[model samples]
Target chain A: MSTRTELHYAFALAALCALDVAAADAPVAPAHPLDAPAALKAAFAERIGHPVNVLSFGFGEHYAQALVQNAAAPDEFDEYEAVPGRPLEPGRPKKAGEVDCRKKIAFAALDLDAGARALAQARAAAAANGYKTPDNVTLGADVFCNDFGWRAILTSDANDDAMLQIVWAPDGTSPKAQELHDGGWRKVDVAKLLAGSAKVAPAAPKAEPKTVAGDGRKRDFRRGIDADLARLEAEVGAPLGFKHIGIDRTQLSVDVFQSANRKRVSTWLVGDDGAIKLWREDDTIPFDCNKPFAAGDFPLAQLPDLVADAPSRIPPMPQAQVKDVAVYRSGLCGRPHVYIKLEDERGYGNVEYDERGRLVSAQIQ
Target chain B: MAKTAVAKILLALGASLMLAGAVAGAEAPGTDYGWPNLTDFLKQLIAKVGAPVKVYKLAMDRDGKVDLWIQDQAHPDLVDSWEYDHGAIEGPIPVKFDHYPSIAALDHHVIELTTIDFPRLPAMLATARTKLGQPDARVVFIELERGDSSGFISVTDTPIWTIALDSPRHDGRVEFDLQGRVLDVDKD
Candidate 1:
């Protein structure tokens, strides 16, 4: 390897702290060590000896499925269902003699390339020490985000008691305190765990609060409102008509007046810190009275006609077809318009319908 | 990544280690690499990983063996490991695992074992919202994972779901169960 690559690898390797603990540094054992729920964490930290990204730290069976496109073939996506052997879906009935109890599972995401190397290293090490690698894991990046390098997860039971029949932790227990524990709910004890325990998992990364120190914060907001408005005005110009302003302890909202009277207008939440949260001038509040309707409100049968009838040139499309239509009532504009997500400047446009099947307000987005 | 860590490293490697008066328990470890304990070594390691956050729990088991995982700030699982055995904190090489247990691997039980699927995501979210009065928190991401329920002790593979959300009112991630029950609320 080149000196540069060797130095980089050395630096990366040094980044790793420590693995197995030595006998000399062992802390004085508790006079009486009990197998409490906390034992799971202690053992995991002991085995891994690294700061594992605990995904979740509670109990309940959970899973999901999403489509991830093959990088080689961008158009081809594969849908993988990470399901339980016999999962209990929503609204499904529990069966007799069912062993479905709340168990903790911690998982991590690995950088595809790094993961491959790590896996190879692990396999070599495991083989040297009598362990085998599993088969058929390509280690592809997830759909949500691929920039992440790697992730590690583990699970442990919160139950301190060691009764096999006890599916859930005791009601008043500090560790596995569930809302309500009923029959068929089981909690595992750490003593019974094999190498990979089957009881508890770590929690996800904690999210950032809106206010760092109560100075009014939000997600994706811009630096300030005046600057944002100026930028929007520069882009949309005369059409940038916002006429209403509302303020709360945390947020300062502003919107456009549908009618000159300003009675009916859609609301936009500019960050209380005076930042613009979104580039759009509209409110994305799922179901606002201002935006009474959405893409889902319309009938399925009308989708084809709506797509075909949507004016192609009114929005002034350079070239491209409408891939999807999101219909919503623009309370600020005082009209029901369809937001079109296009395939290219002609790519996307919002078309407001006029009487007699004519296009009233069609603008490129 | 953290200035304090770099200072600690540089100070440890300098001539005449003289931090006995600066901070209580600042006496460096008797070992060659320095640092009084595993915790200090971890502080430096955390900085190297581009995360300067507090490093909690550099624990050793009863067998005189300590182990742990340190991913970058992002949750990608590029994992590396080092073992300090019987107070051999200063020497011996470390092990860098190319792969540890991902969600899928944990479910499959090659590297480790756990319940197949821990907590169903959407269902718990619906419950958490109702219990929380359905606050207008912008949900950045909702992840269903199986983690150790009680981390004070051993690691048990249990089911749990974390809903990372933010709102003008407040911001934090709420962890819940499949029945839509709130387990804990971690304010970020």
Candidate 2:
């Protein structure tokens, strides 16, 4: 080997040996003692019905300490120190102070098994170099965000060599996070981990509400009264006045004046469900208008055509002169119809046509 | 070639150590020289099972154990998986449909596992290490599909090899293609 390459390999092997020493420092018993803290977390999550933040976990030869915070109530937490195969020591609920929940440990992303194996690789490399691993060496991982929003730090305390320090940032593409990645720090796949676990996935972006306009364009309907009034003009010939009624403001009433007499010619009642009804003055018998016509009660753009063809659809109501014409939806039958008022010096006669302007019925009173 | 020989030597060393039970059940045993051994295992696998019609996924865990999922031609809905650990192979284990995610176009996106250039894997891994740092956990190879904004369209022809780094960088992954070309670097 060249001098530089040998030095590089030698340094790497030495670092690996130190990492191995760190892995061995943890209490040996339950096959994987480092997993004991995560097991406690899993058990606690099972009890709470969801995963919560683990503020800190301290390892010992026989017992591990964990301080966990409630996910719902972040300020509340409990601290427990427990041994393997034994119940957690009882802990009282405590309040969080000066605790940034954002930096809480991500237990799902913490794989101590991998950390130990990496250390073992380091040990093997050291063995190949014929170096004796120091007995007093210690290695550990601190899996929590430090200053950055990304959680988890897989760092070793072996002679300042940050071997295999992995950090998981939500936005892995961030420059700082990427810098950490370039600096020998591995990034955890939090999305994939959460997918395999019971953790709730991140909220999806809100979808835009779909809208249909008379012009076949996605026009915003919430653009104040002028736009709404303009939309209503397509149904009624220039509404003179508009007002919302009913206890819950679920009804809308509009007055239309097409003639130059300055008198209201037609009154239209629209239900919140998009049902429409029309009323005119000097009517003899009240029409059956209980059921309101809702959405799919014919398009508003077709109203002008229906009104214009109403006269030709029926014969004059028994030689009666046409007094006034009004268009409305027969809410009781859920159909749009045009009502033509007629007068023959007696009282008033009426003729009605469907949305297609086909004559349907006639009545005299 | 010298580096490859060194990797082979390390593989032998790891194998002997594993056989001695010194590093058995260790997550990603012999990670320092795991890539060459994995490629060697895959080459042997193709020789044993022949070329697969569709390769669902190939994954190596922290324990240096490899799992390969290939579609069964006779039963199109079932997938046959083979696991390799410590120089021993286990199973053509049949996995039912829906147990794992399915590709949108399985027939069109066939990964010719047999014809893959196994010799280039070590170099590709070295490039990944240089560009994106070492992987602390596992390596995964799967075909990725592009999902449409409407959630109704599927485009599943992209194949990628992901080198997942250890904790904290759990999201960090260095991506490459079958021909050992670097596709993406880190946490993609």
Tell me, by lDDT, which candidate is best.
Answer: 2
Which stretches of model 2 miss by more than 4 angstroms? A1-365, B1-33, B36-48, B51-53, B99-104, B133-156, B167-171
Binned by DockQ into CAPRI classes (incorrect, acceptable, medium, high), candidate 2 is: incorrect
- Runs of candidate 1 with Cα error greater than 4 angstroms are A1-176, A180-287, A290-311, A314-318, A326-328, A332-335, A345-347, B1-188
Number of the top-ranking candidate, with TM-score as the measure: 2
Give the 10-residue window scoring lowest on summed lDDT in candidate 2 chain A.
Answer: A240-249
TM-score of each: 0.19, 0.29
Least lDDT summed over 10 consecutive residues: which range in candidate 2 chain B? B142-151
lDDT of 1 by residue, B1-188 (tens): 56876665544433222231122123223211112234344333444553332111122332324443332235332233444553343322222322223433322221210111212333344444545443444455554444542222225354455665554333556776545567887652
Query: Which whole-number lDDT from 0 to 100 does residue A142 have in model 2?
Result: 38
* Candidate 1 per-residue C-alpha lDDT over A107-127 given as tens digits, one digit per residue, 9 for 90 to 100: 232122333333333333323
Per-model DockQ against the true two-chain complex: 0.01, 0.01
